[model samples]
Target: MASVVNNVVAAVANASNDEAVCGICLDALDRKRSVTLKPCNHQFHRTCALQWAESVRPDIDRPCCLCRSSVREMVGRNGRRVVRSYPFEEEELDMKRQVLEGLLNEGDSFLISLNNTRDQIRKMLKESEIERAIAEKQRQPDEYVVDIDQEGAKLEKRKHAIDNLLEYGATITALGDAATVACAISRELEALNRSNSDLASEEEDGHYAAEQSHNEDTDSDSDSGSEEEIR
Candidate 1:
Protein backbone atom coordinates (compact mmCIF):
# COMPACT_ATOMS: atom_id res chain seq x y z
CA MET A 1 0.00 0.00 0.00
CA ALA A 2 2.88 2.45 0.70
CA SER A 3 4.35 1.80 -2.73
CA VAL A 4 0.97 2.58 -4.39
CA VAL A 5 0.67 5.88 -2.42
CA ASN A 6 4.20 6.88 -3.51
CA ASN A 7 3.30 6.33 -7.21
CA VAL A 8 0.18 8.55 -6.92
CA VAL A 9 2.21 11.38 -5.32
CA ALA A 10 4.80 11.18 -8.15
CA ALA A 11 2.05 11.41 -10.79
CA VAL A 12 0.58 14.55 -9.13
CA ALA A 13 4.01 16.20 -9.05
CA ASN A 14 4.52 15.52 -12.77
CA ALA A 15 1.15 17.02 -13.60
CA SER A 16 2.01 20.17 -11.55
CA ASN A 17 5.27 20.51 -13.46
CA ASP A 18 3.50 20.20 -16.80
CA GLU A 19 1.01 22.96 -15.87
CA ALA A 20 3.92 25.38 -15.11
CA VAL A 21 5.39 24.85 -18.62
CA CYS A 22 4.37 26.75 -21.83
CA GLY A 23 1.12 25.48 -23.46
CA ILE A 24 2.36 25.84 -27.15
CA CYS A 25 5.53 23.66 -27.10
CA LEU A 26 5.08 22.32 -23.58
CA ASP A 27 8.69 23.53 -22.99
CA ALA A 28 10.24 24.96 -19.82
CA LEU A 29 10.71 28.80 -19.81
CA ASP A 30 14.21 30.04 -20.73
CA ARG A 31 15.74 33.21 -19.30
CA LYS A 32 15.46 35.03 -22.67
CA ARG A 33 11.67 34.41 -23.02
CA SER A 34 9.09 35.92 -20.67
CA VAL A 35 6.13 33.94 -19.15
CA THR A 36 2.59 35.27 -18.74
CA LEU A 37 0.48 34.16 -15.76
CA LYS A 38 -3.29 34.07 -15.76
CA PRO A 39 -5.73 35.02 -12.95
CA CYS A 40 -5.92 31.31 -12.08
CA ASN A 41 -2.16 31.33 -11.48
CA HIS A 42 -1.71 29.26 -14.66
CA GLN A 43 1.55 30.20 -16.54
CA PHE A 44 2.36 29.97 -20.33
CA HIS A 45 4.65 31.24 -23.05
CA ARG A 46 3.95 34.92 -23.86
CA THR A 47 3.68 34.04 -27.59
CA CYS A 48 1.18 31.22 -26.87
CA ALA A 49 -1.00 33.19 -24.42
CA LEU A 50 -3.25 34.82 -27.11
CA GLN A 51 -3.73 31.54 -29.00
CA TRP A 52 -5.04 29.73 -25.93
CA ALA A 53 -7.47 32.52 -25.16
CA GLU A 54 -9.20 32.31 -28.63
CA SER A 55 -9.46 28.49 -28.85
CA VAL A 56 -10.97 27.52 -25.46
CA ARG A 57 -13.77 30.13 -25.27
CA PRO A 58 -17.46 29.32 -24.42
CA ASP A 59 -18.70 31.87 -27.03
CA ILE A 60 -17.82 35.25 -28.76
CA ASP A 61 -19.48 37.05 -25.76
CA ARG A 62 -16.83 35.40 -23.57
CA PRO A 63 -13.80 36.60 -25.59
CA CYS A 64 -11.23 35.61 -22.97
CA CYS A 65 -10.23 32.08 -21.98
CA LEU A 66 -11.05 30.67 -18.53
CA CYS A 67 -7.47 31.49 -17.44
CA ARG A 68 -7.66 35.27 -18.27
CA SER A 69 -9.26 37.97 -16.08
CA SER A 70 -11.11 39.93 -18.87
CA VAL A 71 -11.25 40.16 -22.67
CA ARG A 72 -9.89 43.76 -22.90
CA GLU A 73 -6.84 43.07 -20.71
CA MET A 74 -5.98 39.61 -22.13
CA VAL A 75 -4.19 40.62 -25.42
CA GLY A 76 -2.06 43.42 -24.03
CA ARG A 77 1.76 43.07 -23.75
CA ASN A 78 1.63 43.63 -19.98
CA GLY A 79 -0.68 41.45 -17.87
CA ARG A 80 -3.90 42.82 -16.37
CA ARG A 81 -3.54 45.13 -13.30
CA VAL A 82 -6.65 43.84 -11.52
CA VAL A 83 -6.87 40.08 -11.22
CA ARG A 84 -10.22 38.33 -11.76
CA SER A 85 -11.61 34.84 -11.39
CA TYR A 86 -11.43 33.97 -15.17
CA PRO A 87 -8.78 34.76 -17.82
CA PHE A 88 -7.90 34.24 -21.52
CA GLU A 89 -6.18 31.16 -23.04
CA GLU A 90 -2.63 31.54 -24.52
CA GLU A 91 -3.30 30.28 -28.10
CA GLU A 92 -6.36 32.49 -28.70
CA LEU A 93 -4.63 35.70 -27.58
CA ASP A 94 -1.66 35.26 -29.97
CA MET A 95 -3.88 34.68 -33.03
CA LYS A 96 -6.10 37.68 -32.18
CA ARG A 97 -3.08 40.03 -31.85
CA GLN A 98 -1.57 38.94 -35.19
CA VAL A 99 -4.86 39.44 -37.05
CA LEU A 100 -5.37 42.92 -35.58
CA GLU A 101 -1.81 44.03 -36.53
CA GLY A 102 -2.26 42.82 -40.13
CA LEU A 103 -5.52 44.77 -40.55
CA LEU A 104 -3.95 47.95 -39.14
CA ASN A 105 -0.98 47.75 -41.55
CA GLU A 106 -3.28 47.22 -44.53
CA GLY A 107 -5.38 50.26 -43.57
CA ASP A 108 -2.28 52.48 -43.27
CA SER A 109 -1.00 51.41 -46.70
CA PHE A 110 -4.39 52.03 -48.32
CA LEU A 111 -4.56 55.57 -46.91
CA ILE A 112 -1.09 56.41 -48.24
CA SER A 113 -1.99 55.24 -51.79
CA LEU A 114 -5.23 57.23 -51.72
CA ASN A 115 -3.38 60.42 -50.76
CA ASN A 116 -0.85 59.99 -53.57
CA THR A 117 -3.56 59.48 -56.19
CA ARG A 118 -5.36 62.67 -55.06
CA ASP A 119 -2.17 64.72 -55.33
CA GLN A 120 -1.48 63.47 -58.85
CA ILE A 121 -4.99 64.34 -60.03
CA ARG A 122 -4.78 67.85 -58.58
CA LYS A 123 -1.43 68.51 -60.29
CA MET A 124 -2.81 67.36 -63.64
CA LEU A 125 -5.86 69.62 -63.31
CA LYS A 126 -3.71 72.66 -62.49
CA GLU A 127 -1.45 72.02 -65.49
CA SER A 128 -4.45 71.74 -67.82
CA GLU A 129 -5.79 75.12 -66.64
CA ILE A 130 -2.43 76.75 -67.27
CA GLU A 131 -2.23 75.34 -70.80
CA ARG A 132 -5.74 76.61 -71.63
CA ALA A 133 -4.83 80.12 -70.45
CA ILE A 134 -1.65 80.10 -72.51
CA ALA A 135 -3.53 79.07 -75.66
CA GLU A 136 -6.05 81.89 -75.21
CA LYS A 137 -3.24 84.40 -74.73
CA GLN A 138 -1.57 83.21 -77.93
CA ARG A 139 -4.81 83.61 -79.96
CA GLN A 140 -5.37 87.17 -78.68
CA PRO A 141 -2.42 88.61 -80.62
CA ASP A 142 -3.63 87.10 -83.89
CA GLU A 143 -7.08 88.65 -83.47
CA TYR A 144 -5.56 92.04 -82.76
CA VAL A 145 -3.32 91.85 -85.83
CA VAL A 146 -6.25 91.04 -88.10
CA ASP A 147 -8.21 94.00 -86.75
CA ILE A 148 -5.29 96.35 -87.31
CA ASP A 149 -4.79 95.13 -90.87
CA GLN A 150 -8.47 95.68 -91.73
CA GLU A 151 -8.39 99.23 -90.34
CA GLY A 152 -5.23 100.05 -92.30
CA ALA A 153 -6.82 98.87 -95.53
CA LYS A 154 -9.85 101.18 -94.98
CA LEU A 155 -7.60 104.19 -94.32
CA GLU A 156 -5.56 103.56 -97.47
CA LYS A 157 -8.67 103.42 -99.66
CA ARG A 158 -9.99 106.71 -98.19
CA LYS A 159 -6.63 108.42 -98.86
CA HIS A 160 -6.66 107.28 -102.50
CA ALA A 161 -10.19 108.68 -103.10
CA ILE A 162 -9.26 112.06 -101.62
CA ASP A 163 -6.21 112.32 -103.93
CA ASN A 164 -8.41 111.73 -107.03
CA LEU A 165 -10.86 114.49 -106.01
CA LEU A 166 -8.06 117.00 -105.58
CA GLU A 167 -6.61 116.33 -109.05
CA TYR A 168 -10.04 116.76 -110.78
CA GLY A 169 -10.67 120.09 -109.04
CA ALA A 170 -7.30 121.47 -110.25
CA THR A 171 -8.08 120.53 -113.91
CA ILE A 172 -11.52 122.29 -113.82
CA THR A 173 -9.96 125.48 -112.41
CA ALA A 174 -7.41 125.66 -115.32
CA LEU A 175 -10.16 125.38 -117.98
CA GLY A 176 -12.18 128.23 -116.41
CA ASP A 177 -9.15 130.60 -116.49
CA ALA A 178 -8.59 129.98 -120.28
CA ALA A 179 -12.24 130.75 -121.13
CA THR A 180 -12.13 134.13 -119.28
CA VAL A 181 -8.99 135.28 -121.24
CA ALA A 182 -10.60 134.50 -124.66
CA CYS A 183 -13.73 136.60 -123.86
CA ALA A 184 -11.65 139.68 -122.97
CA ILE A 185 -9.71 139.68 -126.32
CA SER A 186 -12.92 139.39 -128.45
CA ARG A 187 -14.48 142.55 -126.76
CA GLU A 188 -11.37 144.75 -127.50
CA LEU A 189 -11.42 143.86 -131.30
CA GLU A 190 -15.10 144.86 -131.73
CA ALA A 191 -14.53 148.39 -130.30
CA LEU A 192 -11.63 149.12 -132.76
CA ASN A 193 -13.72 148.22 -135.90
CA ARG A 194 -16.60 150.69 -134.96
CA SER A 195 -14.17 153.73 -134.77
CA ASN A 196 -12.68 153.09 -138.27
CA SER A 197 -16.13 153.06 -140.02
CA ASP A 198 -17.10 156.56 -138.63
CA LEU A 199 -13.90 158.26 -140.01
CA ALA A 200 -14.46 157.02 -143.65
CA SER A 201 -18.09 158.50 -143.86
CA GLU A 202 -16.99 162.12 -142.90
CA GLU A 203 -14.30 162.39 -145.70
CA GLU A 204 -16.78 161.52 -148.60
CA ASP A 205 -19.34 164.29 -147.65
CA GLY A 206 -16.74 167.21 -147.86
CA HIS A 207 -15.64 166.44 -151.51
CA TYR A 208 -19.29 166.56 -152.88
CA ALA A 209 -19.86 170.28 -151.62
CA ALA A 210 -16.75 171.69 -153.50
CA GLU A 211 -17.93 170.49 -156.99
CA GLN A 212 -21.39 172.34 -156.84
CA SER A 213 -19.85 175.77 -155.96
CA HIS A 214 -17.54 175.79 -159.08
CA ASN A 215 -20.46 175.27 -161.55
CA GLU A 216 -22.48 178.37 -160.36
CA ASP A 217 -19.51 180.81 -160.92
CA THR A 218 -19.13 179.87 -164.67
CA ASP A 219 -22.84 180.84 -165.66
CA SER A 220 -22.59 184.36 -164.23
CA ASP A 221 -19.46 185.32 -166.40
CA SER A 222 -21.18 184.45 -169.82
CA ASP A 223 -24.27 186.75 -169.28
CA SER A 224 -22.09 189.78 -168.57
CA GLY A 225 -20.21 189.50 -172.07
CA SER A 226 -23.53 189.58 -174.19
CA GLU A 227 -24.79 192.94 -172.84
CA GLU A 228 -21.55 194.63 -173.69
CA GLU A 229 -21.86 193.68 -177.50
CA ILE A 230 -25.41 195.22 -177.92
CA ARG A 231 -24.29 198.53 -176.68
Candidate 2:
Protein backbone atom coordinates (compact mmCIF):
# COMPACT_ATOMS: atom_id res chain seq x y z
CA MET A 1 0.00 0.00 0.00
CA ALA A 2 2.81 2.40 0.91
CA SER A 3 4.62 1.48 -2.28
CA VAL A 4 1.48 2.35 -4.24
CA VAL A 5 1.23 5.76 -2.53
CA ASN A 6 4.95 6.43 -2.89
CA ASN A 7 4.55 6.20 -6.67
CA VAL A 8 2.41 9.41 -6.70
CA VAL A 9 5.09 11.88 -7.83
CA ALA A 10 4.53 14.52 -10.55
CA ALA A 11 5.37 12.64 -13.76
CA VAL A 12 4.20 15.56 -15.92
CA ALA A 13 4.88 18.57 -13.71
CA ASN A 14 6.19 20.51 -16.71
CA ALA A 15 3.19 19.72 -18.92
CA SER A 16 0.53 22.10 -17.54
CA ASN A 17 -0.78 23.44 -14.27
CA ASP A 18 -4.10 21.70 -14.81
CA GLU A 19 -2.28 18.37 -15.19
CA ALA A 20 -1.06 18.64 -11.59
CA VAL A 21 -4.56 18.59 -10.05
CA CYS A 22 -5.22 15.53 -7.89
CA GLY A 23 -8.28 13.62 -8.93
CA ILE A 24 -9.33 12.90 -5.38
CA CYS A 25 -8.60 16.31 -3.83
CA LEU A 26 -9.45 18.13 -7.07
CA ASP A 27 -6.65 20.60 -6.28
CA ALA A 28 -3.19 21.41 -7.62
CA LEU A 29 -0.11 19.64 -6.22
CA ASP A 30 1.24 21.60 -3.21
CA ARG A 31 4.79 22.77 -3.96
CA LYS A 32 5.66 19.99 -6.49
CA ARG A 33 4.49 17.54 -3.82
CA SER A 34 2.86 15.02 -6.15
CA VAL A 35 2.87 11.36 -7.13
CA THR A 36 1.84 9.40 -10.23
CA LEU A 37 0.32 5.91 -10.37
CA LYS A 38 2.20 3.41 -12.51
CA PRO A 39 3.41 1.52 -14.60
CA CYS A 40 0.82 3.86 -16.30
CA ASN A 41 1.14 7.59 -15.63
CA HIS A 42 -1.41 9.57 -13.46
CA GLN A 43 -0.28 12.18 -10.92
CA PHE A 44 -1.85 13.28 -7.63
CA HIS A 45 -0.85 15.13 -4.49
CA ARG A 46 1.39 12.90 -2.32
CA THR A 47 -0.71 13.35 0.83
CA CYS A 48 -3.97 13.07 -1.16
CA ALA A 49 -2.98 9.74 -2.67
CA LEU A 50 -1.26 8.40 0.47
CA GLN A 51 -4.37 9.18 2.49
CA TRP A 52 -6.62 7.59 -0.12
CA ALA A 53 -4.36 4.52 -0.34
CA GLU A 54 -3.92 4.35 3.43
CA SER A 55 -7.71 4.27 3.81
CA VAL A 56 -7.66 1.04 1.86
CA ARG A 57 -5.18 -0.49 4.40
CA PRO A 58 -5.69 -4.29 4.44
CA ASP A 59 -6.90 -4.25 0.83
CA ILE A 60 -3.76 -3.46 -1.11
CA ASP A 61 -5.56 -3.90 -4.41
CA ARG A 62 -7.91 -0.95 -3.89
CA PRO A 63 -9.04 0.87 -7.06
CA CYS A 64 -7.85 4.35 -7.91
CA CYS A 65 -10.52 7.07 -7.54
CA LEU A 66 -9.89 8.35 -11.08
CA CYS A 67 -10.18 5.07 -13.00
CA ARG A 68 -11.55 2.02 -11.17
CA SER A 69 -8.28 0.06 -11.60
CA SER A 70 -6.29 -1.29 -8.67
CA VAL A 71 -3.41 0.83 -7.52
CA ARG A 72 0.07 -0.71 -7.25
CA GLU A 73 2.86 1.88 -7.69
CA MET A 74 3.16 5.70 -7.74
CA VAL A 75 6.05 7.62 -9.30
CA GLY A 76 7.53 11.16 -9.18
CA ARG A 77 8.23 13.59 -12.05
CA ASN A 78 11.96 12.75 -11.82
CA GLY A 79 11.03 9.09 -12.45
CA ARG A 80 12.17 8.10 -8.92
CA ARG A 81 10.27 5.20 -7.39
CA VAL A 82 8.89 5.81 -3.87
CA VAL A 83 8.24 3.31 -1.08
CA ARG A 84 7.26 3.52 2.59
CA SER A 85 10.59 2.82 4.36
CA TYR A 86 9.33 4.05 7.74
CA PRO A 87 8.08 1.88 10.60
CA PHE A 88 4.55 2.86 9.56
CA GLU A 89 3.55 -0.20 7.55
CA GLU A 90 -0.15 -0.38 8.37
CA GLU A 91 -1.30 2.72 10.19
CA GLU A 92 -5.02 2.27 10.58
CA LEU A 93 -7.46 4.87 9.14
CA ASP A 94 -11.26 4.60 9.48
CA MET A 95 -13.91 6.18 7.31
CA LYS A 96 -17.30 4.86 6.18
CA ARG A 97 -17.56 4.86 2.37
CA GLN A 98 -20.17 3.61 -0.06
CA VAL A 99 -18.87 0.51 -1.88
CA LEU A 100 -16.72 1.91 -4.69
CA GLU A 101 -19.08 4.89 -4.36
CA GLY A 102 -21.76 2.66 -5.86
CA LEU A 103 -19.60 1.83 -8.90
CA LEU A 104 -22.68 1.77 -11.21
CA ASN A 105 -25.25 3.69 -9.24
CA GLU A 106 -28.71 2.17 -9.09
CA GLY A 107 -30.36 5.22 -10.66
CA ASP A 108 -28.18 4.90 -13.73
CA SER A 109 -29.61 6.28 -17.00
CA PHE A 110 -29.56 2.79 -18.45
CA LEU A 111 -31.96 1.55 -15.81
CA ILE A 112 -34.55 4.13 -16.86
CA SER A 113 -34.74 2.59 -20.32
CA LEU A 114 -34.91 -0.89 -18.89
CA ASN A 115 -37.83 0.09 -16.72
CA ASN A 116 -39.64 1.62 -19.67
CA THR A 117 -39.23 -1.55 -21.69
CA ARG A 118 -40.52 -3.65 -18.85
CA ASP A 119 -43.60 -1.48 -18.49
CA GLN A 120 -44.32 -1.55 -22.21
CA ILE A 121 -44.10 -5.33 -22.29
CA ARG A 122 -46.31 -5.70 -19.25
CA LYS A 123 -48.97 -3.40 -20.63
CA MET A 124 -48.98 -5.17 -23.98
CA LEU A 125 -49.46 -8.61 -22.44
CA LYS A 126 -51.83 -7.72 -19.61
CA GLU A 127 -53.76 -4.68 -20.81
CA SER A 128 -53.83 -4.91 -24.60
CA GLU A 129 -56.01 -7.86 -25.67
CA ILE A 130 -53.97 -9.61 -28.36
CA GLU A 131 -56.77 -12.16 -28.69
CA ARG A 132 -58.82 -9.37 -30.26
CA ALA A 133 -56.51 -9.47 -33.24
CA ILE A 134 -57.29 -13.14 -33.77
CA ALA A 135 -61.04 -12.51 -33.38
CA GLU A 136 -60.95 -9.72 -35.92
CA LYS A 137 -59.16 -11.93 -38.43
CA GLN A 138 -61.70 -14.70 -37.87
CA ARG A 139 -64.63 -12.32 -38.47
CA GLN A 140 -63.14 -11.07 -41.75
CA PRO A 141 -61.15 -14.05 -43.01
CA ASP A 142 -61.02 -12.78 -46.60
CA GLU A 143 -59.43 -9.55 -45.38
CA TYR A 144 -57.59 -10.83 -42.31
CA VAL A 145 -55.04 -8.16 -41.42
CA VAL A 146 -53.18 -6.76 -38.40
CA ASP A 147 -51.56 -3.33 -38.21
CA ILE A 148 -48.29 -4.09 -39.95
CA ASP A 149 -46.89 -0.68 -39.19
CA GLN A 150 -47.51 -1.05 -35.45
CA GLU A 151 -46.02 -4.53 -35.43
CA GLY A 152 -42.92 -3.32 -37.23
CA ALA A 153 -42.51 -0.44 -34.80
CA LYS A 154 -42.72 -2.71 -31.78
CA LEU A 155 -40.20 -5.11 -33.28
CA GLU A 156 -37.80 -2.30 -34.13
CA LYS A 157 -37.91 -0.83 -30.63
CA ARG A 158 -37.26 -4.21 -29.02
CA LYS A 159 -34.35 -4.90 -31.34
CA HIS A 160 -32.76 -1.51 -30.84
CA ALA A 161 -33.09 -1.61 -27.03
CA ILE A 162 -31.75 -5.12 -26.70
CA ASP A 163 -28.90 -4.42 -29.07
CA ASN A 164 -27.89 -1.37 -27.05
CA LEU A 165 -27.97 -3.32 -23.81
CA LEU A 166 -25.84 -6.16 -25.19
CA GLU A 167 -23.30 -3.73 -26.63
CA TYR A 168 -23.13 -1.76 -23.38
CA GLY A 169 -22.61 -4.97 -21.40
CA ALA A 170 -19.76 -5.98 -23.68
CA THR A 171 -17.94 -2.64 -23.40
CA ILE A 172 -18.49 -1.87 -19.71
CA THR A 173 -15.50 -2.20 -17.37
CA ALA A 174 -17.73 -3.89 -14.80
CA LEU A 175 -20.10 -6.47 -16.27
CA GLY A 176 -21.99 -7.70 -13.21
CA ASP A 177 -24.74 -5.09 -13.08
CA ALA A 178 -24.79 -4.61 -16.84
CA ALA A 179 -25.08 -8.32 -17.63
CA THR A 180 -27.89 -8.74 -15.13
CA VAL A 181 -29.86 -5.85 -16.60
CA ALA A 182 -29.31 -7.06 -20.15
CA CYS A 183 -30.54 -10.55 -19.35
CA ALA A 184 -33.66 -9.22 -17.65
CA ILE A 185 -34.46 -6.98 -20.61
CA SER A 186 -33.78 -9.77 -23.08
CA ARG A 187 -36.25 -12.00 -21.27
CA GLU A 188 -38.90 -9.32 -21.48
CA LEU A 189 -38.31 -8.95 -25.22
CA GLU A 190 -38.59 -12.72 -25.68
CA ALA A 191 -41.95 -12.70 -23.93
CA LEU A 192 -43.20 -9.94 -26.22
CA ASN A 193 -42.07 -11.85 -29.34
CA ARG A 194 -43.74 -15.04 -28.17
CA SER A 195 -46.96 -13.20 -27.50
CA ASN A 196 -46.89 -11.67 -30.95
CA SER A 197 -46.15 -15.01 -32.65
CA ASP A 198 -49.03 -16.74 -30.86
CA LEU A 199 -51.42 -13.94 -31.76
CA ALA A 200 -50.37 -14.07 -35.42
CA SER A 201 -50.70 -17.87 -35.60
CA GLU A 202 -54.19 -17.76 -34.13
CA GLU A 203 -55.20 -15.10 -36.62
CA GLU A 204 -53.91 -17.18 -39.55
CA ASP A 205 -55.80 -20.25 -38.34
CA GLY A 206 -59.03 -18.21 -38.03
CA HIS A 207 -58.59 -16.94 -41.60
CA TYR A 208 -58.02 -20.48 -42.93
CA ALA A 209 -61.09 -21.82 -41.13
CA ALA A 210 -63.26 -18.97 -42.46
CA GLU A 211 -62.04 -19.51 -46.01
CA GLN A 212 -62.81 -23.23 -45.83
CA SER A 213 -66.32 -22.55 -44.49
CA HIS A 214 -67.05 -20.03 -47.30
CA ASN A 215 -65.84 -22.48 -49.96
CA GLU A 216 -68.06 -25.27 -48.59
CA ASP A 217 -71.14 -22.98 -48.66
CA THR A 218 -70.44 -21.92 -52.27
CA ASP A 219 -70.15 -25.58 -53.42
CA SER A 220 -73.43 -26.53 -51.69
CA ASP A 221 -75.25 -23.63 -53.46
CA SER A 222 -73.73 -24.55 -56.87
CA ASP A 223 -74.82 -28.22 -56.45
CA SER A 224 -78.39 -27.17 -55.53
CA GLY A 225 -78.63 -24.98 -58.69
CA SER A 226 -77.34 -27.84 -60.92
CA GLU A 227 -79.88 -30.31 -59.44
CA GLU A 228 -82.75 -27.84 -60.17
CA GLU A 229 -81.51 -27.35 -63.72
CA ILE A 230 -81.32 -31.15 -64.24
CA ARG A 231 -84.95 -31.59 -63.00
Off by over 4 Å in 1: 1-20, 35-37, 56-231
Q: What is the lDDT of residue 195 in candidate 2?
A: 48
Reference-based TM-score of each model: 0.21, 0.29
lDDT of each: 0.37, 0.45
Highest lDDT model number: 2
lDDT tens digits by residue: candidate 1, 25-114: 455533112234433444444445534543555355333232224544432223423212122122322322322232234533433443
Q: Pick the candidate with the highest TM-score.
A: 2
- Candidate 1 is scored at a TM of 0.21
**Candidate 2 lDDT, 13-40, residue by residue in tens:** 3447655556665555533346788755
Clashes (candidate 1): 25
What CA RMSD would you report for each candidate? 62.7, 28.1
